[model samples]
Target: TICGLFGFELDNFERAEVQKATRRLLEHEKRFLERGLRNFLIYKDMFLKSVYRAGLPEILIYLPIIESGCSPRARSRAGAVGLWQLMPSTAYDYHLRIDYWVDERKDPVKSTEAALKYLKRLFGYYGNWELALAAYNAGPANINRAIAMGKTRDYWILRKRGVLSRETSWYIPRFYAIVRIAENPAEFDLNIENAGKKFTFQVLELEKSLSIRELCRRAGIPYSEIRFLNPELRRAITPPGRRYNLKIPAGSLAPFLSAYHGIKKEYIEDVAVYTVRSGDTIGEIAERFGTSPSLIKLINGLRGSLIYAGQELVIPVKEGGLINKVPIRNNFRNYSSLISSSIRYTIRRGDTLWDIAKRYRIEMEVLLALNGIGYNEVLMPGNEILIPVNPLLSP
Candidate 1:
């Protein structure tokens, strides 16, 4: 066999689907292929290492090329994200966090592990890589229904009988075409000199909140460097109240640690340090910070709202400090004012995304795009979501 995928041998290059995808990649999608190929070279080692550790084939590294054009930050309209295109629900099920703080779906290493576990599970259940891969595109339930309707476990049969959706039917062949070309790039005149190089980084345990910009200034590196390594940071800052694993640029540990030690204890970004003035109140402070009094108290560890004048308080500045200065919920103004800038909204009882969209008078599609979610995506109570104040903005 000239090509083998998962456990299936493929000597049938004459198949219309596989050959057609190959030509399209070579011609119409050539530019797209070139871009994805370049990105694949950069992250090749990172993707392949996880595949290897999971005991999967090296060819599986090409899956991301098919899924997201090898971009870690790529996201589908359906809200699937990262190299593996994991949905929010699936990411949550696999212990990946997607929130106002971070979306771990964009984390290369972590998402790879979670995705590989899922693929392994699918393969194990179906006992056929083709079926598993088909299920990966269309959900398992769809694949199951396809199998039952077609009266066969074979993906090609289901695809041939139109039991599989158009997208799912093409997904496998596109994947195969990509793998065949990638397995021997030289044959296609593709040059990837550092394709085998690994993505190396030194992990720094951050105990307090720090913005990417401040960290970059301290580490003497570009903000893009740290951001490139940590795509999960939603606000470009590590959250407080937990220790975060921050991946710094490879070989920058010495300088980063040196600058980090001299920083003040309470110094953090996305927050304002205020000295309580005479006649000051928690409600006043909260309003000024675009946050709730409860959040301010919780953050400062205040049991009751008893405070003396001249006491320093850390007030989270939401709007530009960076996630959006979300006004305390009840005091929200008219939709025009509220939707003019980014704001964080906590889902209240009996609230649906559509209802919120109606309240804001924003299109449901626009609202979903702003949050990088689908119309059908779940909105749980107490979960904070970002809302775009500007009508022209898209996620």
Candidate 2:
């Protein structure tokens, strides 16, 4: 049924699995489908152009709809980001920049380009769209192992042989279902034309550092508008000491240029020092500081998701811009003075995570996250547990 659909056909489109997935979307998850389609239609033009320029299939644009609900800033807990939901490693592999001031994974244009390139590569590797879709959800390494184990190149055959992960086995069918519904929305009791007007924006190139708050003030634009237009900026401020490109609302160039020239030049604002507290997570700290976990990690030179108590972090802030959800204590240590120290505590018989967390004045979840333990973890005696010990932290 997908014949002459999108310049490629890797499987039968009318499979019962695909039909069940479609029914699941239309009957059980219609709200999400509607919302996701609304966002997809908003960026339809931009997404189409990207697909065309990359010489990819038109149906490819729907991938982001399924991946991120077409939200430019959507991120997974595993650190995949943007409309395409690219993991940091994959983003880096595609030459998408992920740094302190900006994460290109959140940039609509850059991330789309990177995602299309990745998809093309995967498609080329498998020579089948269904397999490529499966590989995208579960990495190619997993797919390769599945192929070798099953002695098959066909995705469905490998799926039938139970050589593919349950997630991957279901992924392609769900994708096919989305594509089918998108092709003929009327059959699904949905309408694509209702997605609304085009999302419009203009890019401005700047030579000096500037905070988004100041820019919005000068240009007479709403802070939320600017943030929506430029979701890739990790902080309110632009990259220091570099020529940066920022996006603003469409047709606001005249006012922005006039206002920009009149406003006094400014530099990056001073950073606020924060001492990581007991039970602190990078995500919680980022939410408190009006920044992102990616930004916090970049600033602190942290390579992983874990942050221990007593670690000093430099919070990127504009004047009084941080969200005050927490009564955060300021350690005031310079970024250069950032330090993290920890001690090992050997688990004793009858020791529990909750008891140990209470003794250390940290949360039980923090202990589990720190040690990568499961919620129902059974402590083994003599096993050493990593307990964060910061000198500045209260006993």
Off by over 4 Å in 1: 1-6, 12-14, 191-198, 265-395
Clashing pairs in 2: none
lDDT of each: 0.73, 0.72
lDDT of prediction 1:
0.73
lDDT of 2: 0.72
Model 1 vs. true fold: TM: 0.71
**lDDT measured at residue 62 in model 1 versus the true structure, 0 to 100:** 81
Q: Which lDDT tens digits does candidate 1 get at residues 56-161?
A: 7666788888899888888765556898998655675677765445677889889999999999899999997888888888889999999999999988888889
Q: How well does each candidate superpose onto the true structure, as a TM-score?
A: 0.71, 0.69
Give a tens-digit lDDT track for model 2, residues 1-395: 33124645645677888888888889987887887888888788898899889888888888887898889877654446799988655765676655445667888888989999999999888888888888899899999999999999988899899999887888888888888887677777885565355667898888766556777888888989887777887666676545787887899998888777776554434455577899999888877776667656555556798877866576655445562433333222122111134456788889988778778776443454344343354667776655655567637
List the candidate 2 regions with Cα displacement exceeding 4 Å: 1-7, 191-195, 268-395
